[model samples]
Target: MSLLNGIFPKMKMTRSSNQSTIVSLADKEYKKDRPLVKMCGITSARDAAKAAEAGANFIGMIFWPDSKRSIPLPIAKEISRKRWFLAGGVNHMNVCEALSILRPHGIDVSSGICGPDGIQKDELQILSFMKAVHSVHY
Candidate 1:
């Protein structure tokens, strides 16, 4: 098993499952009024700043060359101080370990929240993902 799967074995979900079915095994309840939200695949400084202004807890810089949303390192550095997360193919499976290792202010997601089309962000999936993440005590 991959290291992430080993660390967070419960993150896996079948494609047949509904968006609401994605759950986490976190035993602790997050009491915070709102967990930090990080929007990934930011391509421009204007968009990055806009996300920050819109109350996004963190911005994500995509460094993976395979990702359509990937940005150059220089651009990433420009917005490095804006409370950001490094993201590309981040998902529920690796999020727990990523949080454990990086311990950033928040985590970001993209394809994880998308529908089968892999483009449109599904509201139900987003809600479920958020719920799972927020359920973590840490």
Candidate 2:
């Protein structure tokens, strides 16, 4: 019987579930002036270093258990720092969770944001994902 018990009755709460009002990258804006050069399918520390050196604005490391690209948290965190922004998973649901956990500059999703057999992107989900990204200041 906590203060938020009924308000979010079904919420699966965790230490990282709470939202913070403290915005850090408020001054920065996303611009195509410097394109979002992302390194997808980052598998190792070497790959992350290479992507960082290559001037990638983001690097994706899969966290989805089913994906071949998935890497351990320790390895992923090691690759992720102040340098290249880390993106996790190839699914929308996991991307959202990753956002809560990693707080990466950007998020990347493929299958979960798409329809069966990668037919098309779901507009609502895409918008929701983008909104989630915009809500947090990097």
Candidate 3:
């Protein structure tokens, strides 16, 4: 990631607790008040739809061949129903505070909802995290 960061110093790279990276190409038009929300580490269409229904601006499917969180192309195709990330250490517990304080144009999340083994995403946590994001209105 440092190498990539060196090459693209303008890009912001976020790494999850599990060491998986999520990179975001931010646009200047992003709104600080109603920021875009990106949910990463999605492996199922169900989760993708859930995030969208919860009002996520984008959903990211991991494609890194080396990461356990990476999904297969077919599954990725299926989840193309939604799209996009790269933020780290975000979860249900602290996301609200982060959003309220930083007021960023968009958010990137990943292992924030992963289970103890850091291999599987927790559906309940997903809900909690989304709900928290929704609760913070500007």
- RMSD of every prediction: 16.2, 13.4, 15.3
Q: Which regions of candidate 1 are displaced past 4 Å?
A: 1-31, 89-138
TM-score of each: 0.42, 0.55, 0.40
Best by TM-score: 2
Report lDDT (Cα) of residue 1, candidate 2. Answer: 26
TM-score (C-alpha) between model 1 and the true structure: 0.42
lDDT tens digits by residue: candidate 2, 1-138: 232222211101112235421111112334434444667778775676566555555567777777788787776665555434444444544554566566665555666666565769888777776776655554
What does candidate 3's lDDT look like per residue over 58-98, in tens digits?
66555445677776556555445212432456788877875
For 22-106, candidate 1 gives per-residue lDDT tens digits of: 2122222332555545667888766765665565555677755788887766666554542356677655555555554444445
Stronger candidate by lDDT (1 vs 2): 1
Which 10 successive residues of model 1 have the least lDDT summed? 7-16
Model 2 ranges off by over 4 Å: 1-36, 54-57, 83-92, 131-138
Sort by TM-score, top down from the best: 2, 1, 3
